[model samples]
Target: MIAFLKKRAKMSFLLLLKVLRFYWLLLNVWHFSRTKISYEAVKWRNISIYFHFKSKIIKYLTSNILSKINISLNSSNKNFSSYIK
Candidate 1:
């Protein structure tokens, strides 16, 4: 009886860890998705002064396009899923 309880406790702990890991992964992906501009800036930070300015411009353009695309895709996905349901 005690051994069975111990096994159940260990299984639950493992399941809890799995759930936490899944949530951690999702949060990491969300954080990365929101860091596009910062990523570009950091990428060019140590390279050169000239490229740093270029990176800022590229980052701004990229983030803008990405946000617009994300919005459109979300709207489209919602519409498509609505049809399916």
Candidate 2:
């Protein structure tokens, strides 16, 4: 029983070490990046910047169309489930 407990204890210690190592790696990468921005976040940020710039061209046209259509600005998409994958 004592030997089995020692083996279990050693396994638990090794698992804890592995988890700490993984966390340390993530922290090291975050520190190196200095902004905590992951690859996907950077990609999305670039896309948002592009879209914002493009929106300026349509801003006037959309406003005129909206006024003519008389659509309420407060209305939202009630079928939220369609947005989920």
Candidate 3:
């Protein structure tokens, strides 16, 4: 299994990633059936977790970038004033 992927990876990295994703999804489906769990439950949990992680990262980055922009603007304003005088 790993050896097959390694061979495909040498041919194309994108194809290798697709193969891995499909393999994992097949594994999850097999587990879900054995456990008699609702697929919707797993799907919901996965979607929520992905969204929560993305939102947190975006919010943190936005705040950081905004702060940096504000600092740059304030410094430039001071320089402009010195030039005018």
Candidate 4:
């Protein structure tokens, strides 16, 4: 009976650990979802400002990398420009 009780105690501990792990994951997911929703709820002007800065950084990085690689941004093809417009 003591052995059975010990086994039951071990099982209960494992179950408690599993429940704690599940709650931890649930909390993390809830936090991320809340963050995402709050970010999305931001004003369009603020979001655009964020994106504008992001694009500038990206453009700077790409331009520097491409220049290092000797790749020209200005293509001689007029057809490509027309197609883009």
Candidate 5:
């Protein structure tokens, strides 16, 4: 009976150790996944901001060019009309 009890105790101890190791592995996996997700979020946000700023710059430049063209056309029309008169 004593030998049987000793064997059972050892088995229980080994089971407990295996459970602890499994939990440790699960915790590490959870931590790594969370970190990876946060890193990707930040990286995508920066890329979106960069594209937004680039679009704004292009819009501003095009608008300026259009206004300048309108001004030059109006001036030329006035000069031509005056010359004809």
Candidate 6:
């Protein structure tokens, strides 16, 4: 899994965000359509899922960004050392 991500390192971050949004929307639709939904239950569920989804997106995007930044910085340092020699 990590290897696959490393291979596709050039994919745009916006695309990943769009994919996550799509999945979240699908889940939200499913939750809204539940036959057992009540006013209070729906409100509670919406609040919980909203926070859960927001946190997951933030965590994922930030992790990806940090990983990419680390990789880029490491590569630049390596190149700088080679250039100095």
Instruction: List model 2 lDDT by residue over 11-67, tens digit each.
Output: 999999999979966865675599866777766765887799889768978988888
lDDT of 4 by residue, 1-85 (tens): 9999999999999999999979965865676688775545444545687799999999999989988666443553555787989
Model 3, 16-67: lDDT tens digits are 8789989978987987989878999778866898799999999999999999
Ranking according to lDDT, highest score first: 3, 5, 6, 1, 4, 2
lDDT of 1: 0.82
- Candidate 5 C-alpha error for residue 60, in Å: 1.0
Q: State which candidate, 2 or 5, has the greater TM-score.
A: 5
Q: What are the lDDT scores of the predictions, listed in order?
A: 0.82, 0.75, 0.90, 0.76, 0.85, 0.84
Model 3 regions lying over 4 Å from their true place: 1-20, 23-27
Clashes of 4: 0
- TM-scores for all candidates? 0.43, 0.40, 0.60, 0.41, 0.51, 0.52
Q: Tens digit of lDDT per residue, candidate 1, span 1-85?
A: 9999999999999999999979965865666678754655543543576587889999999999999999999999999999999
After TM-score superposition, the amount by which residue 71's alpha carbon in candidate 5 deviates from its true location, in angstroms, is: 0.5
**Residue 30's C-alpha lDDT in candidate 6?**
75
Q: After superposition, how far is residue 44 of candidate 3 from its true place, in Å?
A: 0.6
Best by lDDT: 3
Model 2's C-alpha root-mean-square deviation from the true structure amounts to: 18.6
Q: Give candidate 4's whole-model lDDT.
A: 0.76
Model 2, poorest ten-residue lDDT window?
Answer: 71-80
Say which prediction, candidate 2 or candidate 4, comes out ahead on lDDT: 4
Sort the candidates on TM-score, descending order.
Answer: 3, 6, 5, 1, 4, 2
lDDT of 6 by residue, 1-85 (tens): 9988976764767679889989976876677787756557766777998899999999999999999999999999999999999
Between 4 and 5, whose lDDT is larger? 5
Q: Lowest lDDT 10-mer window, candidate 5? A: 37-46
Backbone clash pairs for candidate 6 read: none
lDDT of 3 at 12: 99
Clashes of each: 0, 0, 0, 0, 0, 0
